[model samples]
Target: MKLYQLKAKQAFPISKKEAWDFLSDPKNLKVITPDHMGFNILSGADRPMFQGQIIQYVVKPFPGYSTKWVTEITHVKEGEYFVDEQRFGPYTLWHHKHFIKEIEGGVEMEDIIDYKIPFGILGQIAQPIIVKKQLQQIFNYRETKLNELFGKLEGHKNYLELKSI
Candidate 1:
């Protein structure tokens, strides 16, 4: 089995507290994720995140099928960062860390994920064809959705500035 890592960072034109309040909640995952992915949270998000918190969800990574995913919040540092590891999921291994920091204009949120597919050789072969692209699309969708929700931050503008035009 080969280990894979995906890193993504985005600056939200919002305060660290606001960022933490939204991102740290498991229910918000559905809001940011693509609709076709069939992301649904089966756990409550009313309380603040803490270590050993288990969140359950159903995700349809492929068409006509759904899989249940369970992740345990292993570490949390209030407004700074949190870590989640997959307890039962599609992948053989999944470790995800989320970090938020106060930057020049807003809060910078970063996601670092390490995952390995299960089917050994076959999974490795499908990495480039399917796994990699699917993961990238998920993160890309998140970035776009966040930009729509919070506006764009300085140094990360993707669209043409109206002032420049």
Candidate 2:
């Protein structure tokens, strides 16, 4: 199996607390995910995210319909960082580390994901184009979502709540 890894970092012009609150909220995943992907919260969004917390969603990258993906919060360190792993999803292995560092003006969020698709050689051939595109799209959508939600707070070191836009 070929190991696929992606690292992404984004600066949010909001307080560490605010960023943590919004990102930690299980419901916000659907809000940040690209609508075209058909991302929807399947469970436990009403509660705060913590270790062992599971969030479910459906994604349709193409026209055939949707597939369910579930991730569990395996590690959390308050306002600093978290790690989520796929419990049941469309992959052989999915392990993601989400880290948040407080910057001078706002917060920097970083994602390190290591995943492997099933299907052996076929996955290797297809991932170069499609899976990569989907990953980029997901992160791009997240950046857009952050700007839409906290654009006004850019460069602010502190915030009160993770209110929706």
Candidate 3:
């Protein structure tokens, strides 16, 4: 099985508490996500994020493909980090970790996602042409959205990378 990993990091000119408050609230996901993805929270987003929390959503990853994704918040460490795992989703395996740290004059947010695609060999064939590009676009949009919401930290180079593991 081929497992893929995506790592993204961005620095923001905002306080750690401020960043935590925005990111910890599940509803804000729609704000950071690209509108073209047709992302919507179906349920389990009425309250603050916590361990064991289940969040469901409807997402159109591609045209004519709308799917219901259910993810469980498996871990949460207040203002530091949190983990979400896919319970029912498109991928065969989806584990995402989000972290935030206080940096000089701001806060830095990091995301690491490890996932395995379905359909085995066919999925591997489509990885570069479809999956990887889609993920890149999604993260790129998120970075832009976050920069607009909270100004970027000068001299901090943000990056996003995807690779096989």
Candidate 4:
């Protein structure tokens, strides 16, 4: 199977600690996610983020159908970055990394996601027509919601950029 990569970056007008506190807590994911996706966290919000943390959620990737996604926080470095890999989900492989850095004015948040679709040849066919576009829309919604939440940092044009690798 071929692995596809997506990278998204956004600068938030907030301190590194503030950004870490918000993003590290998986509970806040529902806040930033679009309502159309039906994203809901099944795990408790009180747990602290650490290696081996398991998070469960249900999302409607397509109309009238719900998919349960389970991911494990495989690696973490406080105030720096964290990695989450899918244990069970729609994709055959899902590895996502979130990075945060202290920039000039505020904190910069970046997300790198590597995923592979299932169904062999059919998956390849769907990647361009469906999966790619769907992922873009999801990230676009996230960027807008994040700007509304923390306000955007100065001097950045695009909130998120996606490309294959």
Candidate 5:
């Protein structure tokens, strides 16, 4: 089996506590996600982000089709990191780890995703082309969204003040 992994990192000019609060809440997903992909939470998990917490979502990456993805939180460390595994989703297996740290300037967040596409021969054939391409698209969107959100908060004093708490 071919193992595929994607790693992404970004630093925000925000405190670790603020970043933690925003990312810990599952409902903030759509606000930070790219609009073109049409990602929305289908069902907010019953429990907060913790080991074995399941989060269901409906995502439309392609036209005319909505994929239902159910991911479970497998590991979590408060104000630091969390891991979400896909129990039933499009991919054969998906394991994603989100890491956060308080750096000198601000908070740094890292996303490490290990996933395998369905079907043996098909996965090998499509990895270099299709799967990799889609991963890039999704991550690029995420980066842009983060910049915009943080940029707005930084430029507006009142907004930043309100979120200061």
Candidate 6:
């Protein structure tokens, strides 16, 4: 079995609390996600994020193809970090970790996602051509959207990278 990892980091000119408040809220996902993705929350987003909370979403990852994704907030540490694991989704395995830290003039947010695609070797072959590119686009859109929402930190370059493990 092959596993893939995606790591992204961005510094925002905002306080740690401010970043935490926005990132911890599940409803704000759609606001940061690309509109073309058709990301919509189906349920489990009425209140604040908490451990064991399950959130369901319907996403159109590609043209005319939609899938139901269910993820559980398995861990949360107030303003520090949180983890979400996929219960049911397109991927065979999905575990995402989000972290926030206070920096010099603002806060830096980081994301680490470890996932395994379905279909064994065929999925491995498609990883670079399709999955990697799609995920890169999604995170790119998110970075742009976040920059618009909260101004970017000066002299700090955001980064996103995906690699096999």
Write one digit per residue (lDDT tens) for candidate 2, span 128-148.
777887787788778767878
Model 2 scores a TM of: 0.88
Output the better candidate (2/3) by TM-score. 3
Summarize candidate 4's per-residue lDDT along 94-160 as a digit string, tens digits.
9999999998889899999998989998998889899999998988988989889899998976545
Q: Which candidate, 3 or 4, would have the higher lDDT against the true structure?
A: 3
Ranking by TM-score: 3, 6, 4, 1, 2, 5
Poorly placed runs, candidate 4 (over 4 Å): none
TM-score of 3: 0.99
| lDDT at residue 46 of model 6 (Cα atoms) | 99
lDDT by residue for model 6 (39-108), tens: 9999999999999999999999999999999999999999999999999999999999999999999999
Candidate 1 residues 1-165, lDDT tens each?
478888788888899999999999887889999999999887755567889999989999999989999999999999999999999999999999999999888988888888888888999888778888888888889988999999779786432111100
Better-scoring candidate (TM-score), 2 or 5: 2
Off by over 4 Å in 3: none
Q: Which prediction has more favorable TM-score, 1 or 2?
A: 1
Which 10-residue window in model 6 sums to the lowest lDDT?
29-38
Evaluated against the true structure, the overall lDDT of model 5 is: 0.76
Model 2, C-alpha of 105: deviation from truth (Å)? 0.9
Write one digit per residue (lDDT tens) for candidate 5, span 91-133.
9989888888987667778887888888898877887677777
lDDT of each candidate versus the true structure? 0.86, 0.79, 0.97, 0.89, 0.76, 0.97
What TM-score goes with each of the models?
0.92, 0.88, 0.99, 0.95, 0.85, 0.99
Task: Summarize candidate 3's per-residue lDDT along 46-152 as a digit string, tens digits.
Answer: 99999999999999999888999999999999999999999998999999999999999899999999999999899999999999999999999999999999999
Identify the runs in model 1 with alpha carbons over 4 angstroms from their true place: 44-46, 157-165
lDDT of 2 at 129: 71
